[model samples]
Structure formats: structure tokens, C-alpha cells
Target: MTVGASVKQTLANLKGAQGTLRTYSIKVQDESARSIYAEALMTTNKVIDDLNKRLKTIELEEPQYRAY
Candidate 1:
């Protein structure tokens, strides 16, 4: 696949992981486990945000990728 497509796929996977982390954070009874999941979720969120910005820049730089 193209670079843009690969990045988009990675972003989607990260988002799915974030959702799973959210669920785990809420459902688990162990306080330590919950805290760990929360921290991981926060880190994933930051990466997602940075990747989204990078995707925007990619789209801007390569108009052809905007539709994908």
C-alpha cells in the first residue's frame, strides 16, 4: 500500500487500541491495572494526535492523498 494508506491504517489501529484500553480501564477491578491502562491510553492518545497532525500535513503536501 501507499505511505498515506499505511499511515491511515496505523492510525485506525491505534484508535481501536485506544478504545480497548478505555474499556479495560473502566472494567478492571484492580486499581493498579486500571492505572496502568489509563497511562497507556493517555500515551496512545498523544501519539494519535501527533499522527493526525502529520496526516494533515501529508494531505496538504500531497493533494492526491486527500481523498484516501
Candidate 2:
């Protein structure tokens, strides 16, 4: 697949992982585990945001490669 497509797929997978983390955070009973999962979810969210910005830059720099 193309670079744009690959990046988009990675974004999708990250989002799915974020969802799973959120769900686990809510379901877990231990406070420490919950905190860890929540922190991880936040980090994943940041990565997703960064990837989105990079994707936008890529699209601008190469319109033909736009995958969104």
C-alpha cells in the first residue's frame, strides 16, 4: 500500500487501541491499574493527534497522496 494509506491505517489502529484502553480503564477496579491505563490512553491520544497533523502536512505537500 501507499505511504498515505499506511499512515491512515496506523491511525485507525491507534484509535482502536485508545478505545480499548478507555474501556479497560473504566472496567478495572484497582486504582493504580486504572491510572496507568488512563495515562496510556492519554499518551495514545497525543500520538493520534500528532499523526493527524503529520498526515495533513503530507496531504498538503503531496495532494495526489491524500488518503483521508
Candidate 3:
């Protein structure tokens, strides 16, 4: 697979992980566990944002093709 495709796949996986973390945080009764999950969620979100920015940069740097 190409770098772009790999990055996109990673972004999707990270988003899924973030959603799972959020759900776990809400369901867990232990305060510590909740806090840990929340922290993880925050980190995952940051990573996702970074990946998106990088993807945008990559898209801008790569050439586009058009068929006339």
C-alpha cells in the first residue's frame, strides 16, 4: 500500500480507538480507571489531529492528475 493509504488507515484506526476509550470511560465505575481512559482518549485525539494535518500536507505536496 502507498503511504497515503497507510496514513488514512491509521487515522481510521485511531478514531475507532478513541471511540472505544470514550465508551469505556463512561462505563467504568472506578475513578482511576475512568481517568486513565480519559487520558488515553485525549492522547488518541491529539494523534488523530496530527495525522490529519500531516495528511493535508502530504496531499498538498503530491501532484494531482486530470484526464482531459
lDDT of 1 by residue, 1-68 (tens): 76777899999999998999999999999999999999999999999999999988888899876764
Local distance difference test, each candidate: 0.92, 0.91, 0.83
lDDT of each residue in 29-64, candidate 2, tens digit only: 999999999999989989999999988888888898
Residue 28 of model 3: what lDDT? 100
Clashes of 2: 0
Using all chains and alpha carbons, the TM-scores for the candidates as numbered come to 0.93, 0.94, 0.89
Q: Given candidate 2, what's the lDDT at residue 4?
A: 73
| Model 2 error, position 11 (Å) | 0.3
- Clashing pairs counted in every model: 0, 0, 0
- What global local distance difference test value does model 2 have? 0.91
Candidate 2 — which residues are off by over 4 angstroms?
none
> Please, what are the lDDT tens digits per residue for candidate 3 over residues 22-51?
999999999999999999988998899899
Predict model 1's lDDT versus the native: 0.92
Clashing pairs in model 3? Answer: none
